[model samples]
Target: CSSCKESLEDQCSSINNEDNSTINNLKEKLSLISNFQEINLEKSLTLAAEVGTALLQENDELRQQLHLTKFEKSFSELELEDQLEESSKKIEKLINEAN
Candidate 1:
């Protein structure tokens, strides 16, 4: 009976050692996972900033194009009006000379 008791004590000690090893391995895996997450987070932030800057530059370019289009349209309208006014004056002079 004393020999059986000693064997059981040794088995318990072996089981404890295995358990401690498993716990340590799990802790190391958790630390690695945490570091990986931090690295990914920084990469995500950097990409987002780059995308935001690109979008802002595109918006500014579109705004400039719009302003140029508006100016060109205004200039065209003024030219058409001037041409029409000159034609009307010439027609009035012709009618007066005929009278």
Candidate 2:
């Protein structure tokens, strides 16, 4: 009877140890998952920020290009007007000389 009792006790202790080991492994896995989730969140935010910055820079470049185009168009119109005035003056002088 005493030997039987010892055998049962040993079995119970072994089962408890196995359960504890399983519980520890699950806890570690849970912690690792939580850390991974946090890291993923950080990476997502960083990527979003980088994309936003790139878009902003692109918009600024487009605005500058549009401004330069407008300036050039205005300059060309002014130059054409000046040339037209000079031609009109020349024609008037030629007619006066003929008369």
Candidate 3:
């Protein structure tokens, strides 16, 4: 009975050692995962900042293009109005000469 008890105690000690080792290994893996997650988060933030800057620049460029288009449209409309007025005046002169 004494030998049986000794055998069970040795087995329990071995199992405890294995459990401690497994626990330590799991902790190390968890630490590595946490480090990787931190690095990924930093990279994601950097990328997001870069994308935001690019979008702002694009928005400014689009706004400038829209302003230029509006100016051109206004200039073209004024030119067309002037040409129409000149043509009407010429028609009036022709009608007066014919009368």
Candidate 4:
């Protein structure tokens, strides 16, 4: 009977050790998961900031291009008006000479 008690006690102790080992492994896995989540969150935030900055730069470039286009159009209109005035003066001079 004493031997049987000893055998049973040994079995219980072995089971307890296995449970402890499993618990330790689970704790390690949980810690690794927590660390990975933190890293991912940080990277996501950094990427978002970069994307936002790029968008603002693009917007500024587009605004500058628009301003330049408007200036070019206005310059072209002024050139056309000057050409028309010169042509009118030439026509008046030709009429006076013919008369």
Candidate 5:
């Protein structure tokens, strides 16, 4: 009976030790997952900021191009008006000479 009791106690101890090891491994895995999540969050924030900056720069460039196009259009209109006025004066002069 004593020998049987000792064998049971030894078996119980072995099982308890294995349970403790499994719990420790699970805790380590949880810690690693938590660390990875934090890193991913930081990377996501950084990427968002970079994309925002790029979008702002693109917006500014588009606005500048729009302003330049408007200025060119205004200049072209003025040039056409000048040419029309000169042609009209020439036609009037020719009519007067004909008279």
Candidate 6:
């Protein structure tokens, strides 16, 4: 009866040790998961900031391009008007001379 009691005590002790080891492993895994989640969140925020900056830059560039295009169109219209006036004057002079 004493031997049976000793064996049972040893088995219970072994089971307790195994349970402690399993708990320790689970705690370590939880800590690692928390660290990984934090790192991922930081990386996502950084990437979002970078993307926003790039989009703003592109918007500014497009605005400048639109301004330049408008100026070019206005200049062309003025040039065409001047050419038409010169042609009209030349035709009038020719008609007067023929008369």
Ranking by TM-score: 3, 5, 6, 4, 1, 2
Mind giving the per-residue lDDT tens digits that candidate 5 earns over 4-92? 44655565566556555655665665566557646667656765565566556556655655665576567668879999999999999
The TM-score of predicted model 3 comes to 0.60
Error of 6 at 88 (Å): 0.9
Q: Which candidate has the highest TM-score of all?
A: 3
Badly placed stretches (over 4 Å) of model 5 are 1-39
lDDT of 4 by residue, 30-56 (tens): 566567646667656765565566556
Tell me how far candidate 5 lies from the true structure as C-alpha RMSD in angstroms: 34.1
lDDT, candidates in the order shown: 0.64, 0.64, 0.64, 0.64, 0.64, 0.64
Worst 10 residues of 6 by lDDT: 1-10
Q: What would the per-residue lDDT of candidate 6 be over residues 31-82, giving only the tens digit for each residue?
A: 6656764666765676556556655655665565566557656766887999
lDDT for 49 in candidate 4 is 69
Residue ranges of candidate 4 with Cα displaced over 4 Å = 1-39
**Worst ten-residue run, lDDT, model 1?**
1-10
TM-scores of the models, in the given order?
0.56, 0.56, 0.60, 0.57, 0.59, 0.58
Residue 50, model 1: lDDT of 55
| Candidate 6, residue 76: how far the Cα is off, in Å | 0.8
Model 5 local distance difference test score:
0.64
Clashing residue pairs in candidate 3 (N, C-alpha, C atoms within 3 angstroms): none
Clashes of 6: 0
